[model samples]
Target: MRNVTDRIFQGAISVFIRKGLQATTQEVAKEAGVAEVTLYRRYSTKENLFITVIKNVLEKKFDSHVLEIAKENETEVFLMNIIEDRLEILSKNYDLVKMLLSESLRGNLANEINLPDIIFSSLKKGLEYHFELKNQTVDIDFCARQLGGIFLSYVVLPNAQPFNKLTLQEKKDIARKHAKAVLATI
Candidate 1:
């Protein structure tokens, strides 16, 4: 039941992100290939269903991966991937991201999810992974959000421009430099 619910919700995130929550349950159910009744059966209401979808994606994609990567030995490399690799992940889900951002600005607060907690969580994980040595000390959460905010901005950019407005190699090169700047605070 949970797996089915999660799958439906993940699909919902894609649909909702693409079409906005003003998008009907029927459309989402169609995207999910589940009956509309099935979504209502699992979620009870549109708001509840949207929340479920947001929370699940938040945990599975955004939170977990950041935590896992923060544990890596090479913090620089790990951070670079967070900055760059995650952008690739965004490319695959660009439409959804586009919808989410637009919806947020249009007075759909109920449709929103927690931002600071998510940012703080990723930062904490990154810090834990990067600064385990006894002699080193760093404010992991602050730096994470600072740098993470920068990356997040890049993610939600118009997508009309490539990451660097150039080839893949150029984006990676820029990301590498950005990652270094992010690390400089640590």
Candidate 2:
């Protein structure tokens, strides 16, 4: 039963990425390889279905997509871990990221999901492991905004900006610099 629901949702995810959250039930049903009546019986409404889809994606990503980012580097050395991991994800799932960033610009996604704040986790853990203390309870939300804003600006940058066309090393440098800037505040 759960697998059936997940399959339906996975199909819906593809539909959402290909189309949008406002797509029709008929389209979703077709995408899920189920009859329209079957879909309606299962979900009752498109909003229910869409929310379920979003919830499922969020849960799954939290469990699986958000990798455990840890580093042996003390102090500023922990910075590169943030950059390398994010760049890896951005490079592979560029389109999904593009979607997230674009929708965020249009005020689509939530004001950043609050839990599973891996950045804070990394900082606290790194600091403690390095035998340091007195770190404040960081504003995880603001850090989320900072990172999101960076990616959003980078993705939407005009073709003419040299920084927009930065090489991998330049990208890493910029990303690390931004991460360090935020880390200082946290």
**Per-residue lDDT tens digits of candidate 2, residues 1-186?**
456676688778777666665578888878777788877788898767766666565545433423334324443445455554544444454455455545555655553432234334443444444333334454555655665555445545643434424577876787678778867766
Off by over 4 Å in 2: 1-3, 62-67, 70-77, 97-144, 158-175, 183-186
Q: 73, model 2: CA deviation in Å?
A: 6.1
Worst 10 residues of 1 by lDDT: 111-120
**Winning candidate number (lDDT):** 1
1-186 in candidate 1: lDDT tens per residue? 456665687678777877777878888888777899998888888878887777666556556566566656676777776776556555555565566667667867462465436545765766666677333577876676767676577765555675634587876786788778877877
lDDT of 1: 0.68
Superposed on all Cα atoms, model 2 deviates from the true structure by an RMSD in Å of 5.7
Per model, state how many residue pairs clash.
Answer: 0, 0
- Kindly report which residue stretches of model 1 are placed more than 4 angstroms away from their true locations once superposed: 1-7, 133-135, 158-171
Compute each candidate's TM-score over C-alphas. 0.76, 0.59
